[model samples]
Target: TRKVRRNFVAEKYAVLIDALYGGRASQYIETQVSYEDGRTNKVAAELRIEDAETFPPGAVKQAA
Candidate 1:
């Protein structure tokens, strides 16, 4: 008699790696970045971006 192997066993044994690393279990809030001026910048939600269409009528260039 042949032994019955389960194909579902492999699918259930998949390993999931989390962002956790080292002895510290804290999650990173923002990534550390830098500018061309040799100054570092902390990335946060405070950054503001104006929509291109919301700019003043004459502020943007139009296609000739």
Candidate 2:
């Protein structure tokens, strides 16, 4: 999180966002991320997605 990207949410966490509604077993993958100490490390994980409860349609109001 040191070498911060402007749009890191979409770049990094898009998978989790997509899988939030539907469950998935993602394949193992590696990514190079920077640290606060200016050091870089290889981050690896096999992400497991779990389904989440959602509100009923039209249950929540949209933000203006």
Candidate 3:
């Protein structure tokens, strides 16, 4: 049997709860990520922070 690995982990990153204040949903995001190669990347994407509260119990939000 063979296995495949994914480079990006979908659940590893997210927006801070404080960022959403009485908002119905998230519209955009600004993030900075550093790879193991010592390179940093900036990206913008549509977000839905409404589920921030529903995240699993042990999920941790990393600092920017």
Q: Write the per-residue lDDT of candidate 2 for residues 1-64, one digit (tens) a residue.
A: 4786758867787666666645555545578899999999998888765556899999999899
Q: For residues 36-62, what per-residue lDDT tens digits would candidate 3 score against the true structure?
A: 999999988886765535667669787
User: What lDDT does the true structure give each of the candidates?
Assistant: 0.45, 0.72, 0.61
What does the lDDT read for residue 8 in candidate 2?
81
- Deviation in angstroms for 2 in model 3? 33
lDDT of 1: 0.45
Off by over 4 Å in 3: 1-19, 49-64
Cα lDDT, model 3, residue 23: 60
Clash number by candidate, in order? 0, 0, 0
Who is ahead in TM-score, 2 or 3?
Answer: 2
Write model 1 residue lDDT over 16-45, tens digit each, in one string. 112222233333344458889999987643
The TM-score ranking, best first, is 2, 3, 1
Most accurate candidate by lDDT: 2
**Which ranges in model 1 have alpha carbons more than 4 Å from their true place?**
1-28, 45-64
Q: 58, model 3: CA deviation in Å?
A: 19
